[model samples]
Target: MKVGLLFDARNPDGWRRPWARHYARILELCEESDLRGADGVWFTEHHLFADGYLPQPLTLAAAAAARTRRVRVGTAILQPALRLPAQLAEEAALVDLISGGRLELGLGAGYRLPEYALFGADLNRRFRQTEANIREVRRLWSDGGITPGPIQDPVPLWGGFYGPRGARLAGQLGIGLLHISRPMFEHYRQGLAEGGHAPQTARVGDLLPIILADDPEAAWPRVAPYLAHQMNSYRQAAVEGTDVPPPPLIRSDELRNRDPDGPWGMLDILTPEDAAKRIIEITQGLPVTQLIFWASVAGMPDDLVVRNIELVSEALPPLLQAAHPAHPAHGREREAGPPLAAEGGGRG
Candidate 1:
């Protein structure tokens, strides 16, 4: 399987650092991942947050592109709602050229009402806007008007949309998806078929919150707080501009419940071998071309996060790669677009 590391440079109140220092540290980690042979390095986006979530993923992607030579760089879910399609296309093109054709664009129709309000994007029409913007982006890429075309013939695209309608739209647009729901994935395939693309063309990639460590029981306490912070930030953003009362922050203790089939928020601290087995079982029949896990989740310490990236680069790939021999992805790994996944599968 293709392996990659993702960072959002989150600096929550308790863990806050100088923003410049944080970005530098994050780039250092991305460099570390690339040196360790990670398939890709990715960034996520957000805005108007107290914790200072990453607001400009393309800016960071460009930075990462400059920092790493071997690793693909990407935006996990850059909202196209905030920028004009031509602007988005041009920026992506520049990053693609900078990375030598290693940019994977994952777009989302944004759910945070506060961000939509700040960008003057209509929340109710965000999906349609995303679709329209994508069409315009394609036009810009193909037409002679765009000054510097992207290095890749067609830059790989993926959707961060999770629901059925959005998933179908993503498929119709011939973009890959970031999802884990099998049922929703079926909708994506149906959309692809409806769009005159083969159903076998459906692909997905997900950013798992899981941590890999030598000792699961021992590592749980150390990573749980950071995981909780990551989860709560997403939850808090969901209620940012809505009438619904924000839920209390997730406690580290609540991350317990290791039952394989239980209703646990289920973030496991696993050894490399166990992490491989879990990934294989979890994605047994899915078209998973990219598999990503958080790098330095919620400002996790460099030493600890570095070890995780090392295991990801060195330990996880062979284990997952071996498993893929028995359960292949029907040659989706050979396709040229979306250079994020490895020869087997790429990362987010």
Candidate 2:
């Protein structure tokens, strides 16, 4: 059960200041804490939101790679339709080189009508565009010859699928799948088998919101509103045919009525222990090879975020160690990545 941290870096207060400083600190923490327990770090791409979310992911991945030593870095998702396939391939290769081949490329079709409208892309053709983009990217990276080609061939690509077609495409293309929840795992497994890739051991990651608190009661008050905000945002977005499900705010009742094929209901209430236990169950039942948690959402303060990381680190070891008893506990915590340096000096 490999763990990774996902950062949206949503500046909900609006971009009153440059994000470079904040991002530097974030990367520094990622390197340090990732060494402590996390297996990887991930970031997302969005354009022109009131929250000042990052629009570029490969750039961010490169920055993160430079800061960290052992932890793998990747985009939680790259909106493929926004990029030319060849350009995306080139950037991916460069980042992979920068990270010494420690890149897990997660590609997705563009969502958000605002972004598509801004980019002049037809939203209806998203799946088609993604398919084309994926095909072209593979060709450029694996088959196309450059005058000066990349140091490595065929970087690992994970297809981010929200539905059945995308899952089938991933298996057909022999790429890993990135799903949002556990039920989607069944779809991937079925898709892989149907695609003539039976018994596949391909990688899959589940994305979820996570926080670890000293006390659930104390943490709940602080974290709940932020979690609710996230849920509301998703609910609003889902109405636009985005497939962003509402968070599971009312657990017991929601759990009883849970749609096996739908996204997870709001998870803002689960304690760290319950969250970890749920995660283990989901991973064990699903074909998930990696688990990525959205660690810094709702504008969480840096100190609280670090404490959350520590909590997760503490909680995960015994579980993972017990699960893999044959392996020795090589949990030697490493120092966090270097502090965000000046423009030229820092990993970014």
- Model 1 agreement with the true structure over 188-303: per-residue lDDT tens digits: 99889888888778888888757787777876777778778878888988998899999998788886745667532446677889988888887878888888887777876555
> What lDDT would each prediction earn against the true structure?
0.81, 0.67
List per-candidate RMSD values in Å. 6.0, 5.7
The alpha-carbon deviation from the true structure for residue 301 of candidate 2, after best TM-score superposition, in angstroms, is: 2.5
TM-score of each: 0.90, 0.81
Per-residue lDDT of 1-348 in model 2, one digit per residue for the tens? 567778777656522335777777677767765666677788888776656677888888888888877777888788888878888888888878888888888888856787787788878898889878888887776676332345556676788887777877777677788885555556666766766775556667767655666676665655555555555555455445355554444322232344668755554434556766776666665556667776666565555566666655455645655665654223355344333223232210
lDDT of 1: 0.81
What is the Å distance of residue 219 in model 2 from its true position? Answer: 1.0
**Candidate with the greatest TM-score versus the true structure:** 1
